[model samples]
Target: MPKSKKRAKAAPASKAAAAQTGLSRRSVLGGGAIGSALVLGGGFWGISSFRTYAAEHDLSRVGDGTLAVVQIHDPQCPTCTALQKQTRRALRALDGCGLTYLVADIKTPEGAAFARRFNAPHVTLLLFDGQGGLHRRVQGLQQAAALEEVFSAHKAALT
Candidate 1:
């Protein structure tokens, strides 16, 4: 005589656009998470691909019959940046000195190998003679005057 409980009416989905389109709440959340992961991953990849530290280095020419000064660099280190500023000032002061200024950015494989090969750490400077032989290794943050003196002495030794 009475209607059965199993024959109850269904919930309303006839008016909602998402319900009409057959999209579920779980699916929507999943899609949003995937999209966010992809965007963040791409952004991280882009940042690393075009890193700014020593971006213009050419390690191949380091030993090409020229006296050289190489800085073991790390882009994310504050002390390394300070050392870089000091090195730059010294180089500018010693302009026309035939000493090739180079950077071995540890972020790159070649640069990392170079640093390892010489046992050099970040914020260190390597002085190379005309034949690319290691002459001196100076470590830590240095004043422009001190760097200039070192550069000048090394340059004089080569000449």
Candidate 2:
């Protein structure tokens, strides 16, 4: 066999031995990748936090009862449309749970105007109990599964 070929093969074996004895290239690389990702993610989040958007309505209630969602939605808002679909699906999933879903219309200028009077412009989603105790508030659109989990998590207080 050629010396060069033998040396090339031996190189990998030496690396393997080095790994077995102490630190490996794979472990070091993995740690570096994780560290860099964490830093990048933190920086992105920090910058995002500084950007403020228009506030929505507030959903509030009080009670230790069934799962109830009060959504004050404006028909013209893109986010409101998305939440309508998701809320419908979520309510369907929690069928037998005696969940109450309320969709207060805030579609037109008059609707939006009315909603604003009720603090509807500051919030999108709200979960309340029987006694009208405010449990959860979701600013943006929430998925069906996520809504279910929220209710399930508070099942003890529900029933």
Candidate 3:
């Protein structure tokens, strides 16, 4: 019968040298995974943060001679929240349409006064032309497609 030979273990010095090279399989793979996760998480966080920041514009700037879509929003209103989401989706469809989005948050004095100026309530969308003219006022929740069509037409008419 032939005797089988045992595999030789790597020396501790060689192991240290291998780690110092910084190209070992375990180090490469582990570092790559952690790096990838950090990049992905950072991108996601940045996008979400930007969206949240852009969602709320200065209410006082609504009629600042810019074509804008202002939403009379009450945070407690479910319909208002739904309309806000729908508006965002609609804007995506109308990208480059040159319409600034603003929120008339009813919780603030300025927002409340602005809403009262137009006698608009929560869940209302007030479309203003470039000269701050109230071109259209839509109440209640609307579909993204409809909002897109309306926004596109308004954009075309003004420009």
Candidate 4:
């Protein structure tokens, strides 16, 4: 009878090592891919929502005027926050303007109809020159100087 060759025994796997490798593989190939897809999906949705907001509004109410200001804003929008901050500073510099700021929530469909009349975007800043006239409407995120210029453009109506 021919002698059979003995096979080498395999080393036992370490529980910790197996667990770590399993998790790493899942993260790199499985969950990681899903996570990336979710991020891209969210980004696309956000941009589309912004476009819809822009289209739904008329913005006729934001023309040159001398009245309290009304702003249709999306709090989730960073540009809106920045615009609001800058407009507030400008308003403070000009006294007796009697600008009453009415911040309207219009980031969603329910508020879209009301916001449409204002013709403002998802993020916007508007100033009413205390004379029942709209002086300026600013859209998007802008630097302090640019924002100041927008306020300055309506300097005649500041008082």
Candidate 5:
């Protein structure tokens, strides 16, 4: 009786199969760790860049005897558009209040940095007093009545 040669051929085939798979335990783990490190590093770099940009730009526009309504938003955002409409309605209602409205596009690097510096969320509304002090901060979508109330409360400073 002849012993089968199949078992002898199987050993080399198994080694070839392992080579085709190409990845070892160490390589996969190491690659994953390196990839994660790169992602984290990139995130930190982005944050640093935003901070630097914010520091370079002058965000304080309201000066003595002037009132400012700063709206930080993304033009493409539906919520921001809605907020703009609501803000316009509010401003119309308070026609006599000598307030200035400034729209900052968050898509720009400067805008992004400004929002971060002020800790404002997307579609944020910031009210500044004549002295350039932040009087109120509103985050997210706001109703016309709510915005009007804020303006009304700051009317004395605005005029």
Candidate 6:
């Protein structure tokens, strides 16, 4: 009779070896949750950082020989935040166009007075001529292109 070969059995995993086999499912899930929380927290922080309301002094000073773009808005209003971002982009695009950008918090006393002076409700953009006369009063959020066109028109009218 022919002798049969015996099969070798595999060794079981040791505790240290099993532990070094990379992150477990629970560990990976926990890490992901922590990462997500951190990212979300950072995002909220970033957005909040930009949520500044205009001071009273900011509304009082209007530059001469420049197109004054006064933005009157409430700090807590989402519409105001959206308009603020857009307005910043529009102003940057109109840089060197002899334009002065001003922001006002509608909730402040000075801001309320200014708003009443212009009869603006909220999220208003007031364009002023070089002589500080109201050229255009746009209520609500306006497109950057529209703002640019308005600025150009006012600039032409001023010169």
Say which candidate scores most in TM-score.
3
Cα lDDT tens digits, model 2, 1-159, are: 699999999999989998788767888799899999999999988776554111122223223354567677767778888887887787678776676666556654644664575465533776667877667667777787987787666655667
TM-score of each: 0.65, 0.48, 0.67, 0.44, 0.58, 0.61
Prediction 5 global C-alpha lDDT? 0.80
lDDT of 3 by residue, 80-142 (tens): 999999999999888867899899989888789999999998999999987788989999999
lDDT, candidates in the order shown? 0.85, 0.67, 0.86, 0.60, 0.80, 0.76
Instruction: Please identify which of the two predictions, 1 or 5, would achieve the higher TM-score against the true structure.
Output: 1
Of 3 and 5, the candidate ranking higher by lDDT: 3
Off by over 4 Å in 3: 1-55
Whole-model lDDT, model 1: 0.85
Q: Model 6: residues >4 Å from true position, as ranges?
A: 1-57
Which sections of candidate 4 miss by over 4 Å?
Answer: 1-66, 107-111, 129-135, 155-159
lDDT of 5 at 82: 99
Task: Rank all candidate structures by their lDDT, best first, as comma-separated numbers.
Answer: 3, 1, 5, 6, 2, 4
lDDT of 6 by residue, 77-111 (tens): 99988887887787789878877777777778888
User: If both were scored by TM-score, which would come out higher, candidate 1 or candidate 2?
Assistant: 1
Candidate 2: C-alpha lDDT: 0.67
Worst ten in a row by lDDT for model 6? 1-10
Pairs that collide, model 5: none
User: How good is model 6 by TM-score?
Assistant: 0.61
